[model samples]
Target chain A: MTKLMIKEREVVVPGDIIAEGMNYLPSTGTYRQGQHIMASRMGIMRLEGKVVKIIPLAGKYLPRRGDVIIGKIIDVNIMAWRVETNSAYSAMLSVKDGTSSFVRRGADLTRIYAIGDYIITKIINVTSQKLVDLTMRGPGLKKLDGGRIIKVTPTKVPRIIGKEGSMVVMIKSLTNCDIMVGQNGIVWIKGEPKDEILAVETIRKIEDESHVSGLTDKIKNFLESAKR
Target chain B: MAYKKRSDGRKFDELRPIEAKLGVIARADGSAYFKIGNTEAYAAVYGPRDLYPRFLQNPEKGVLRCSYGMMAFAGSGDRVRPGPSRRSTEISTVTQRALSPVIDLDEFPNAVVDVYIQLSQTDAGSRCAGICAASMALADAGIVMKDMVAAVAVGKIDKTMIVDLDYEEEAFEGEVADIPIAIIPSSGEYTLLQMDGRIEKEDLMKALELGKEVCKKIVKIQRETIRENFKRSEK
Candidate 1:
């Protein structure tokens, strides 16, 4: 018989048996051993249909291919611009992949993307050696300007966006701020000074209360109050 | 044989009071400050970040580096040197070994996780406490692991097997074995085992058993601290 050993939303530590039978598939933050599925990190257990996953409360981001992320240009070389992906691995944005417009060989690459500029890019590839390749040739992918950047836990990025973009859209409409969330936990907000500050506070609140139930209603109430 | 009871009045199998706190350092990815009786230690975990020097980077797994140090005033004697001494280096090696088994290093390639442990006040079982605190710090950092490691020192004092020896008991000379053991409580697999001084083989077995039992209790406290940290963050 299939059995779930842990209650949904319960906190579990490493090696705690989350499920006892193979009927349950283990996802991220968990591993399988014999007939048991055990948590591999300290986090809250999330049960979704047949999948048992753990949502870690804190950790550094590890980049994956095809994720849209905000990165800082740290170094510029002949062939590519090195982008720090808010992770241990640095991604390379080659001059060819950097822009749709092509130019002569050995053209100055720094002028296109200068150091310390934050850009939204998509991960094109991640080699087995952890060499990450990034591309900026997509819609809404380019250098960010005249916006303030704020950081939250990478794991909370999904919560800030909410289900089907409901939460983020609410915050943007209420505060009149244009917000862009990076999968790597960096958020860019641009608006009038007062509205930008309000957006930042609302985002922080969502991050702090992401694990609690009824958070969507609570955040909505908070935004309504802030509007006044 | 009747023997003089310990000055602190603990029974042969009794352990010192434990107090542990997680995420004590705001700047660190994970941190813990804990006290076992008079022995106070702080451990901080940083990274899964880039490994420096390039050569030490493990392509297949992350490197775990531990630096164990003692404050100059931690000891009872004259002012101790304020750097990594021979004793500190050895302790650091053992601490790293004790914690490495639990961490899933393969999850982050070319990364290095650094655990820094400072014993600000030491009784006798400081190394054991350091291991416990370091493991909690790793958990706080959200590092994936197979299990959490708990450790304790069991030594023969006055021909009696005592759990968690203090400074006064450890100062006893000759024939008294001080065996420190760290284990994954759920799996019962030992990650670290070291013995100083000689004891009968049978007594060594007894000490190992006692050490494992006490480690379970410590593990419970570590888990509670981690849970409390997450609960507070929820607000």
Candidate 2:
């Protein structure tokens, strides 16, 4: 009989001593290690009693009823243009929701904001059916273009942005880049060609290591190195 | 009349190259997405946690709830309503039933297991496929289950039983008689059963018989897909 040596949720590694006298088969994700320790049934190298997934977190940008989001105009109809939010659902931008200024005759909506243009907007309503309504007349709501876009793990956006944009501002100052972090994980970075590359790489590294402890200091040190 | 045939001239019953990805949604406790040709479905599992309300609580066993929905642009035609409809409600209920048999609900008494299934594309047998995908997602989430469940549709075309049906074939006369089933191949148990048109009892039996064979094939692929997904996730 193999001995029961670990408690529930104990973190085990590829060769962590598992059962010593227990007749149990290791489930998936577990491998016998060096005739002593055994791999865990789940991901993450375990230490005490916590199973670690250690994978990038994933989820659709779920738009809270009243959160701001930056979106892109994908289509335009007579009454409204469809804006793809960084969420599971898209939003409708009504003519009324746009600026009140109007024109004389058959005014082309494209003249106001053509397709492929990004706008910072606020989600006014989200129905149970997943219909989203948007309004553009708000602080920091406007058009954006001319910069390239990159995506990151949606859950990591908050971490990458940090508290009150401090992390982002720091990155901007160090890399000398214009950066916009969208709530949907779509980041728009524009700067000198070399600076842009550095900024993006830094952001990607932040995303990959967000789950680890002491990321802010690591990022600070990275920025210092990049500056030199 | 077969509405549309593949470039290879295979009948509608022929399933496209199938693939599945487990643990696709990181935030969800367990999640998987699968594709049969272009038709895609995503399933996520959450729970064995606290029951939200007393009314929803089960004393002897845990309650299993399944929500099946489709994205607005899931089809090639036009955008659909993103919310729940009558058809979705029915599918959700049937899916719950299909999953309950395979889950050891008694182990998590007073808790609730919620499965959310989203069809990113719509073809025939999506509901059946959706249930199968959800079961795999539940397993990925580390939720305990008796066994994996698999699903597929057996449509009759040209007076012969065909294993998996596509959209256009769904409306054809011969295909209309088809039945979609969800089963646990290991235990030989039925989780779901539905049909629209009339066929002989023998044909129905034959479809079930043939369905079992197809279900086994689906189960093998589902296992392989989950293994591949986990491996990819590590990298």
Query: Which candidate has the highest TM-score of all?
Result: 1
Residues A111-143 of candidate 2 have per-residue lDDT tens digits of 877788888778889765456898888887777
Write down the lDDT of every candidate, Cα atoms only: 0.88, 0.71
Model 1 pairs in collision: none
Where does model 2 exceed 4 Å of error?
A: A1-228, B1-8, B11-13, B173-175, B233-235
Residue-wise C-alpha lDDT for candidate 1, range A29-113, written one tens digit per residue: 9999889898889889998999999999888888888889999999999889999988778999998899888757888887788
Q: Measured by C-alpha RMSD in angstroms, how accurate is candidate 1?
A: 1.7
Q: If scored against the real structure, what TM-score would every candidate get?
A: 0.96, 0.52
lDDT value, residue B176 of candidate 2 = 53
| Candidate 2 CAPRI classification by DockQ | incorrect
**Clashing residue pairs in candidate 2 (N, C-alpha, C atoms within 3 angstroms):** A1-A21, A2-A21, A2-A22, A3-A20, A3-A21, A3-A22, A11-A46, A12-A46, A16-A37, A17-A37
For candidate 2, what is the TM-score?
A: 0.52
